[model samples]
Target: MSDAVKRLAIRDRIAVLDVLRGLAILLILLMNIPAMGNLESARIDVTGWTAADQMATWLQRVIFAGTQRGMLELLFGAGMLIMASRAMQPDGPVAVADAYYRRNLWLVVFGLAHALLFMWWGEILFPYGLAALLIFQFRTLAPRTLMGIGLVVLLASGHWFGTQQYNARQQLLHDAPAALAIKAEGNPLSDDQSATVKRWEDLQASTKGTGKETQEERTGRTTTLAAFFKWNAKFWMGFTSDLLVLIIFEASATMLIGAALFKWGIIQGKRSARFYLALMLCAYAVAIPMRVIDTQQYMTLALDPRPGWITYQISRLAMTLGHLALVNLAISTGVGRWLLKPFEAAGRLPLSVYFGQSIICLWILFPPYGFGLWGKFGMAGMTAIAVGVIAFQVIVANLWLRWFENGPFEWLWKSLAYAKLQPFRKTPSAIHITAPI
Candidate 1:
């Protein structure tokens, strides 16, 4: 191929990635809307849901919940590898490695700001930043090696979590009598004992609740910015304390798989249509049944302590891969070409769309402000809102790309990563012409 042809091919490949990223971001918003409005609502018992709400929740669980974020993580890893390849071209290995770390350091800064200011405790960027730092060291390893390491770590972490939960439940059971005696006799229990009893009480209570908002939870969904910040601070502190390990592990594992897939050319849409179709078939064959069983167990068991939770991570991975295969198949076969364009545009500017979603959600949901609709929207309402936001973003992204080379935040992030002012605007004659296949 000629140089121009190669460049066009690269661009087209990137556009495909952008479409995937855009789709993933939209799905993430769909998954997060309920939590953004009322954290408890995301976990609302099935009995509490209206038919529409139940349908929406079921759709989200089956289609997007454990899958979308994984796609994003995979893209991040692929992007990292792409950057590493380019950086190595001219600057040598050490300089490229330095650049990689600096980029991730900046991402960490962005993640912190997003989590603290936006009050989104479920932020992935911070965890992605941390995982990037760790995974960078393994860049020289073979793709299969990286994938193997990731799988082992993911499985181990899942098992560890299950073991911890089971042990905690057992401990609580053992300490319940002592706690009762202390309460009845008006005797003070040790702090550790008190904590155990409290955990057990909370776990038991969680099984019976209709997902009603607690006083503290309701207080957090405030109208005033100051109140929101206060609640966010508390939420951040709690989340950072114990859950950080799981977050890091999950992010790292997904990224590792992404790195492997990218190396294998699957992520870049270089795979044959037949390969993708077969992958989709096999992956769903395993994932759908596994997910159904898992969902059924959760509904019936009500979060009962069980070792089976460890296998859930595997099921989620299967579903994630299945989704990836289906997307690649659609794109490769040109079946989704027309529908993919807007998503590709949005994908090209993912950072902007990501923060924009948060800003939009905050305005619409927070009280006495934009809509004062927080805690009022059921699952169906929230899903509708998410779709509306995505549609708006797609339109905005297409319009913005007409004049700008990058999204607002994308330009800023790239500038920060390079420690220089990068070009932001597209030249007058710089329109992207798609290469003919």
Candidate 2:
């Protein structure tokens, strides 16, 4: 086959992979909705929430927290290996290296559009693309090596994050009382004291957001397109930095594990049913309890770091793998395959589905540009609407895929990567998971 053909002609589809990707789409919404709708500072510190919001927050933390992003990172790793494989290249006009880099660069561009244009400051594609570029060199390593390095990075990053949290807690504990004392004495607070008070108040507000904070945020988001863009752009700066520092490291580690998993045949459904079952059970056994405890600590301990923060990386990795194993186990079972069938549409068009979700929620549902329903829903209500949106996307994705070869964004990505307009309508020969989502 020509290099160009190899760049675009991989047609084999892994049912288990599709189902797992589809599951990721479903899982991401459990968290993304509230992040888009609520006050930006209230992501974790829901201090004075109603019982339902608190329960919803804890339940989601236990079930979904890091696993959704984990799945996406790992899948991107799998996709990276698939694209970077030397088997896809030979002496020809098009090179796998060029295609791989081009595809990911365009992904970065798309991510920029998603964040800057569509107003989702927390989008993943930017970091995912950047991480892919950094790690592409490591794809050819042995699976064991990849996994070992990934685990090491994961541990180091987790420790660093935990240490930062611990230090912040210590600072707040020391400074908050001093700042309060100055205020009580009616003395002019020093500059540092004033800054300390601001930090302490922000922390407190994260738990129980003030009306002014929430209202100001809502007004900024819903006042006009310019205002909305400015709000998201400003947030994009800070959020994207955090992603680059900590989240990207975590994502890179997960993707490395993903590359290892793909090579080990675990992600490919080449393992036996018994193997998947044992893996699923073993992984969940290790992760679920830690995650539950972690959530409880974050909820109960004010301004204190979660007990599981240090080892939380292990729990997230284990839980994500457990979810992957469960999906594979389901694929091995006849009934399980049927249940996952609905998700194939989302899996098939991950780029479009992912972007479409932002357009629906950020563009239409919550912003002044659409329903103007920002901050109207709590965690539970936002998630409830997320359920409806997910269902709608699945149905629409299925319908679109029936007559089209690629989702619109997928087609654009491939065309740009290949530097040519590729075929788009459905045909016997079309692309599949030869590349990642």
Clashes of each: 0, 1
lDDT of 2 at 367: 84
lDDT of 1 by residue, 281-337 (tens): 888888777666655565454545544466667777878888888777787655577
Could you estimate the TM-score for every candidate?
0.88, 0.92
Cα shift from native, residue 62, model 1 (Å): 2.2
Pick the lDDT winner.
Answer: 2
Candidate 2 lDDT over 1-437, as tens digits, reads 34533543435666567768877976698778887776775535342367777888888888788888899888888887776665323432346667777788998999899899888888888888888887777877889999999999988989888877777778888888988998889999988889888888777766666635555566678689888887788778977776576877888888998999999988868899999999999999999999988888877746765658678888988998898888888877778877878898788789888888899888888888799878778777777898899999889988987778878988898888778886679776553433321
Please give the distance, in angstroms, between residue 219's alpha carbon in candidate 2 and its true position after superposition. Answer: 1.9
